[model samples]
Target: MAAIQWTDVAQRLKWEATPEGYDRIRTVWLKHCDTELRQDMEGLLSTLTDDCVYTVLRTTATGATRQRWDGQEGARAFYTALFQAFPDQNWQPEAVVMGPQGVFSAVVLNARQVAPWAGIAPTGQTVSIRMFVYFIWAPDKGKFGGEVVYIAPIAE
Candidate 1:
């Protein structure tokens, strides 16, 4: 994969360098992104730990709620459904802060709603969603522990 040109905010902040483990984490993360862009599930899963978990956080009229998928099987299922639903899904990173312990990023997600998502019927509309994603880094294992994502849909 080629180098990614992140958003202006990232360039201004000099995200290319800083955190002690930036290079290592960035390399792995880019690989994860590449695999996802190519819709390669096996390659994507290789970037994560065997027991990695994925959590999606949402806010509603009532309150805040979360949906979590545990273990490798769960990760597989979640990503499989996502890839199937949005075949052209892509991520445009706005900012990324890397640390020895973890990485946090703000991104704009672009996808077409070709299939139901979270029970919502497909509209076949291209949508851009702003999201904050946090990756738990297991330095000792040199792999990500899990991911926590906060989703915020961008109003058109």
Candidate 2:
């Protein structure tokens, strides 16, 4: 493993130094994104390691909300809740970076509130939000070991 240079900025990942490294990261990232887009839970689960950790952080004008999910069962519950809240969701990647540690993506999410989200009742309104997601790669398992998400609604 090469020395990884990490930064707190969203554009931190930088694994373009080698073809094999780039391909490896890109493949896992694309598959993860594709599965999420398709709402294919099983497919997404396949890309994760058994002890994967998933977290979500949402910040609003009022305050911030954070949640975590551990392992396979937790991941399933997290996705289920997300789909229930935003039945129609789409992710448009604004930027993506690949590094020795993981893949980082900044995305714009367009979604419809069809059900309650974080205790807020459904208003059947369309919303656009900015989200930063990181998928940590586990070389030994050749899969993603963890994922972290940060989201904030885009003010109109």
Candidate 3:
């Protein structure tokens, strides 16, 4: 397979903190993920720099799943499908943990059965999963460093 040019995800995601642009980025992320907002995400490539490598950590009481996105397209596709499938998705983030090089995040994922996810539709069933999502991002590289995900079932 041909390599995806560096310019692909690079130019899109700039690190400079702009009062309006950054706000827009946060809003887009929130709206796209929030069940109530249920909005279609656009220009996601611009959300991260080309060098950025997106990642997500999924942990459960039993085990965990770690994944890193290849680039802009990877992140975009994952987020799009994730939101679309679980329309009733909610995440409670306590705070953003910042590190010397990157940042970290802790969040709880509340995924409701509103539609078909992987051919599994809502039978009025619901699953509340508590997870810790860590995002290691870089200011200079204008990309994500890495991610750590942990999960456990929560009784709602």
For TM-score, the strongest prediction is 2
Q: Write the per-residue lDDT of candidate 2 for residues 86-146, one digit (tens) a residue.
A: 9888777899888766888898877888886544467789777788987878766778877
**Deviation in Å, model 2, residue 146 alpha carbon:** 2.1
TM-score for model 2? 0.82
lDDT of 1 at 99: 72
lDDT of 3 by residue, 115-143 (tens): 54332346556555565654444445444
Clashing pairs in 2: none
Residue runs of model 2 more than 4 Å from their true location after superposition: 1-17, 118-121
Ranking by lDDT: 2, 1, 3
User: Number of clashes in every candidate structure?
Assistant: 0, 0, 7
Best by lDDT: 2
Name the regions of candidate 1 deviating beyond 4 angstroms: 1-20, 118-120
User: Residue 129 of model 3: what lDDT?
Assistant: 53
lDDT (Cα, 0-100) at 70 in candidate 3: 59
In candidate 1, where is summed lDDT lowest over 10 consecutive residues?
1-10
Cα-lDDT of candidate 2: 0.77
